[model samples]
Target: MVSDKNSEYKFTGGNSLTGIHKLYHEVMMLNELWNGYGAYEVSYAAGKSGISFGGNQMDMHDNKKTAEKFTNILISATDNAGKHFFTQGEVKMIVGNEFVNLIQNGEVVLSMLGDNLASINAALSSVYGRARIDQLYVSEIKNGAEHIEKVIEKITNAAAKKFYDSDLGRVLLFDYHNQYDLKFDGRFLADYINGKGKENFSTKEMVVAPRDHSKYRAIC
Candidate 1:
């Protein structure tokens, strides 16, 4: 385990999710390691000084008599490494536009909901041996009621945008259709939702990859 001297560091940037995501993702990695499924390499640095290590399921087998020691090592190493990444001016986390607006259609949303849920249910049945998807879906909706309301507001705004932007989008669509003189398919309505057709109806944010784990070790 990393010593308290190494673990004691400062965080300057405020990311609503950065700390939580690191904690949760690291715990998930530990759980996978416990199940003999994953490995992690952790590195620590303070100014010009640094150290690194790694462990895997084989190490856990070697330390089964004192498994908590191994667990602490993994957790502490991850925590300290994350602290370095955040405090050394390496990663910048910016929170922007809590709510995004995009054109949406009720019918399209409903269709997407049905298609996505059906696919989810099928996969859940194969993996978990039953259909708990709808039950969990309802629970999420209840728990996230506030977020749901915000989503509704965004969707409403998007629907209004579709009406206002119809001319440009429609001209583009009409030109495409007229150029090909293609027969209408059911996809036309879905395409009409995005005007000129993008894969997903909503805009998406880009993600940045963090630095690689610098070192690793194993016991077994």
Candidate 2:
């Protein structure tokens, strides 16, 4: 049986990760376009959060995961200067302040535009002043892109991973997981598959539009 690259994905159980892994790269390409490529990209206007850093726009508001994300990146830094910055524990304190600012003021505002490298440097200067780190964040967080890939891998693993068996399926599953964390309805999926009487489902057919979904949604 041949796999349909557009619709169906059949994983060959071997030393090949081409099918699912390639599809992950394809999805990440979209993220790169929207959230900036690599981990060094910073989003200044992150809605209510005020400042978002990293490739995937990890917000600098009361976001615990985002804080942890940066912390791990700093801890994993290869350079002595980068690794030394994390040990000082400034990122945690600054991120904690960001959370407090959000709670008290409803916004964690920053003067940084984060449009380019120069702007990011200025922002880091301001953040370093606040954290009293002597401006190490810029150099340290640049390592974020390298670690962000690992973060995406973890996200992919967390997303509804078992339902579909193709690249298309993984993409759809990741999108669905983004919307509804781990609320995968396996029973409904089995029912839908049985009702359709089809062994393989297409991305087009499998994806559930918000309006077209029932209470027991397969990819909710």
Candidate 3:
């Protein structure tokens, strides 16, 4: 239930996305800008991830978390054809943890026999070839909304069914999705709104991340 109401807020870089896409895509663009990265470039910065790869700045580190993210995205992107190089049966043992380790150090080069896990090399050249792009980028913003909805509903109540129906509300949820702390009940959004004295949200500026958490910093 998105809002039909309009506001004077303008999107940065000016994308053609509308409705939910508009807010979600705009947030991605802002993420790139914040990290000083282009859509295709890879960086060695360590914020959330040791290696930020691709447009969405995905974590390419050698760990369980990264393995899971790549696995899910690979399967979702193409009927599991791309990820089989690491996820296939029995042979998964070879590429499972070692693959991430090889990635963290430098280039990966391997050739195995009778193993369902495909060959891996520097460029990931394999018998299966390259992955086909279903979209410009892979993202899970919609999925994160599942957790965010619970927080919004519990903390903000009427705001979820009402204020959250607007573009601003959607964008706020997207922003919070990145910085959300699991230990908290997602009251950060509600506290942010209250800190700004917004009984009823009135401006796009209110939707931006606060320069300082101010009074709400302690709550988080």
Candidate 4:
């Protein structure tokens, strides 16, 4: 029940007051005192200049109240502090390329589709040849449709990248057995489509972390 200006009053002596009636009386006095004072202000004078008080404190107070009203809206719209959102197609591309990069980097131990482990292994081996590939066989048959749709979307979007420089970017693979890899060689393919390849050739890297860290570590 404390008035806005007298908000500090509760922290002063209210801790000792036992009875509810006593607390009520104290709150009433605080409200009266706050209303009589209008608002608090301070003034400073420099040299012979006249001192001025209450210049824009009231405006600032009003602005603070206005700001509080919209605080929730502001917080909701900008709360991306720790979350990442990706489109279906983008996610597929990232997953596919990440798998390929892992295989090329020799980090993957297995790869599979549904219960078809041997087929998947053979397909990937035939596509990349003798490379170590990881297998992940999906036990749930219900996810097959969604998985296929995502793969197709990723492949369609990825196919647009195959005619530039080999070092331009990592290619996404849809049909490992069929050798369907989406290559974004450079800005050349994009530029060629937009009629700008004649001006410049794109510089890019097809391999991920191509440098040998082991060699650098030995030198160090």
> Top model by lDDT, which number?
3
Best by TM-score: 3
Candidate 3 accuracy as TM-score? 0.44
Please give, for residues 83-146, the per-residue lDDT of candidate 4 as tens digits.
Answer: 2233445333433433331122111212212233232222222312111111111111112223
Q: What is each predicted model's overall lDDT from 0 to 1?
A: 0.26, 0.35, 0.39, 0.24
Model 3 residue pairs with clashes: 3-165
Please state the error at residue 171 of candidate 3 in Å.
Answer: 0.7
Cand. 4 Cα-lDDT: 0.24
Candidate 1 per-residue C-alpha lDDT over 27-124 given as tens digits, one digit per residue, 9 for 90 to 100: 32333223311122222222222221121111211223222322233222222223311221111111012201001222332233343333222222
TM-score of each: 0.14, 0.40, 0.44, 0.14
Per-residue lDDT tens digits of candidate 2, residues 1-220? Answer: 0111211111111112244444543453354224223224333543344344432334545555555544444434333233233343543444354444322212334432123334232332232322322122232223332333333343322132223333455566454332223232332232232232223355435432122223324643
Indicate the worst ten consecutive residues by lDDT in candidate 4. 132-141
- Give stretches of model 1 more than 4 Å off: 1-128, 141-146, 152-220
RMSD of each: 25.1, 13.8, 12.3, 33.0
- Give model 1's TM-score versus the native structure: 0.14
Candidate 2 local Cα displacement, residue 109, angstroms: 4.5
Better of 2 and 4 by lDDT: 2
Deviating ranges (above 4 Å) for candidate 3: 1-18, 33-37, 60-65, 68-139, 157-165, 179-220
